[model samples]
Target: MSTSFSNLSELVTAVKAATDAILTTEPKEVKRIRTGGLPVGTNNQYFTTWDFVNGMIRDHSTCTWYSLLNTFEDERFSLDQCCALVHRFDYTFSNFLRYSGFQEMAVLAAALTKHLPTAKTREEAVKAVRTFLAYLNRLAAWLFHYFPWNIGKHLTYSYTTASIPTPADPDLSRRVHVADGRKVRLTWQPLGICVVATLATKENPELCEDVLRELPFSIIQDHAVVSGESMYAWAPVVSTAPVHVKERQCDAPVGRIRYSQATGNKIIVQYGRVTEDIETPILGEILLQYRDRLGEVGSAVWKSTFETKQIILLTIETVD
Candidate 1:
């Protein structure tokens, strides 16, 4: 005449409420225990008191309480005996405060539930209990990471291939070798340039254009030196000019450019290529050098090449 157990959802809700209540209320008790410190309080009392309380609550909510509810019809345990049994375990609850003690108690709690009166057979009960314990452990790990208290402790970041670009000049043939061993080339130009632009999910197309248009030519010239080549393994050199988007009807270049998401979320002054050579001392013994004449110059560039391309400043945010 074993009693039927509650549905999974109802049981989970009850367990959550009970555990929440115990955890939320224990802060005051913890404060009191801490304040009671030193010789009189002793290391043993300091550790044991709180440990036992938490262990009892966890064990009861997840196991003992559920067992009692389901086994109410079992004649081996009277209602009063069940109540006494719960009380008897209270003294051992503090053992959980010690190293690995809580884990041991959790194991015992699983054992208590494994042999519930309603269990069809011993093997079935053990398997069910093991599965339940595994589920609880997984849930605990998830909650530990997701809870507000653990917010910044274990932060996660994500990136997508489509949003990032390789360091290549739109005017030059851009070749990229993928991790899976494939190389692709992108030929394009800068649509516009901006000193600083906000990067967000929502951006104004016109604003992006205006920012690029307002960028000084000097900045573009400065970035041109480093813009077309990779400085480090993953560094992205900004292009000096906006990359052109091909028109559907005609192959005419649309005034649009693209950008790669910054690596390591850092910024630096970059160089881009210029059609004209600036006045600078030529390196000695360098072959194929041009002086007092205008020719194609190469450097890193940091600005939008097109109205559609965004020159965004980077920022970090946390998500639950």
Candidate 2:
């Protein structure tokens, strides 16, 4: 079928349909030719170039796009030239460069339209369809990496750890792959403290998180895995007082303790403790502001020892 795709959704939909049709009828329609260069009319079942491309996409999951480009390679090369130009000036494909490569595929799709309807011979028609379908497969790969809707055939989920993270019950608790682009929502039981964290990816090498706290008085810091590096950041200790004064006044009350106004004792909270060795690990500092009092504060810039206060159960879920 000769179809003109207006957008990426339309293009991917057409490619999926063509690939499904080709793969479905391949076992029944296809019969290997013996001692022949090309199957002529009535000699073999009629199969389009999309069938060949579908076979390659199914069989060779990790083959490069250049192999498929050979179908269109000739003395006066146009598709390969445009593809090289796109790769050179636009951007290189990598784990981080998904959308840029998808955009490049879209640009190539427009260039491929010029040669679609002009195929005269069977060989030329096969080359034209194969070249177009190959790039469409590449584009679909990028789209599926981020938002996977229908995972069938060759598409599958990748595991981050050796086993799934099932803390309490293996069957009840869920397993999450933070390495992928998944946003995890954690809700602490009993306290109903909710926090969200988007685990780091190759594109964005930073651990993102919301405010996590066991108690309002206890200082909370988050530790996460980012790009194979263990990183941590402390949540800002907010003051609940009405007014805050930065500088000390000349006539201010000095060495005076107000036992009536003080709410409670200062609570120290730390995460990811490090052990002492010949070469100690470099851990960052955390500033603690206790009970909204500027005078009662603590700073641990360079320290060899830290302590873990408590641990609690929490539920994790993959969110949008």
Candidate 3:
């Protein structure tokens, strides 16, 4: 009969006791006994004891136990590395923002691109994809906040021929058939009027209307004049030409008055002499000439062209 026991000492003692009991009961039936050991072919075989002890030791040292410990340690270390990388990236980006003098939103954008996670290996590919998506969302928000001007929807309108009537001179009004066009009476505040007047001759010359086509005059009101009601004293139309006296006592006008249009909702008329040194005036002329291209002049056009050129140059340099 086979017997099983847990402790080594208990197993050895039980075997000895059973052997002794058998020997005493059947001394004559006992086979030749080996000194200091049980017989090779005893009831509990040599193979059984050796196999049981070895199996218990082997079971204790399983691959699953070591693998579990290793996996846990690796995860803890990876988390620490990830946190350190995130902190370092953030610090570097903040420094960049300070040096670059970028707005808060722009700083955030450039920072995220440099610091945002990316897949360097197949193992973390999924995580990289998720991080990239988050970066895109942040970029979109930054652009919207920083740049309010919509590049896609640009509008420009100009008046080719708009008529303005000279104040109630009954005889002149009858003689000169002033086109009774739709009157769009606009009230300009002190600052607004200054802005319009300055831009009329300076930054945007196209906004000025031709004196022959239309006459523009300012009106001061005791009470604010509503669009529908008309109660104001009109200012006189100023001449745009300089009266020049020739050596022979002859007078000649140098320039002519012209009414022009601008891109936005405003009217301007030139009331000054033209000169050779007029680069600023030339810029104004360009504005009038290309009235349809108002929003195209500044950062929008510059950024698009600059970025495209930079990308191409970078690609070429990299290839080289």
The TM-score obtained by model 3 is: 0.15
Residue-by-residue lDDT tens digits, candidate 3, 146-199: 221333235423522233222222231212111222222222332122111111
**Candidate 2 wrongly placed segments (more than 4 Å):** 3-55, 59-80, 83-198, 202-320
TM-score for candidate 1: 0.20
Q: How high a TM-score does candidate 2 get?
A: 0.20
Quote the positional error of residue 192 for candidate 1 in Å. Answer: 36
- Range of the 10 consecutive residues with the lowest summed lDDT in candidate 3: 311-320
Our model 1 lands, by Cα RMSD against the true structure, at 23.7
Task: Provide the lowest-lDDT 10-residue window in model 2.
Answer: 256-265
Score every model by TM-score. 0.20, 0.20, 0.15
Q: Model-by-model lDDT, in order?
A: 0.28, 0.29, 0.24
By summed lDDT, the worst window of 10 consecutive residues in model 1 runs over: 279-288
Q: Could you list the CA RMSD of all candidates, in the order they appear? A: 23.7, 23.0, 41.2
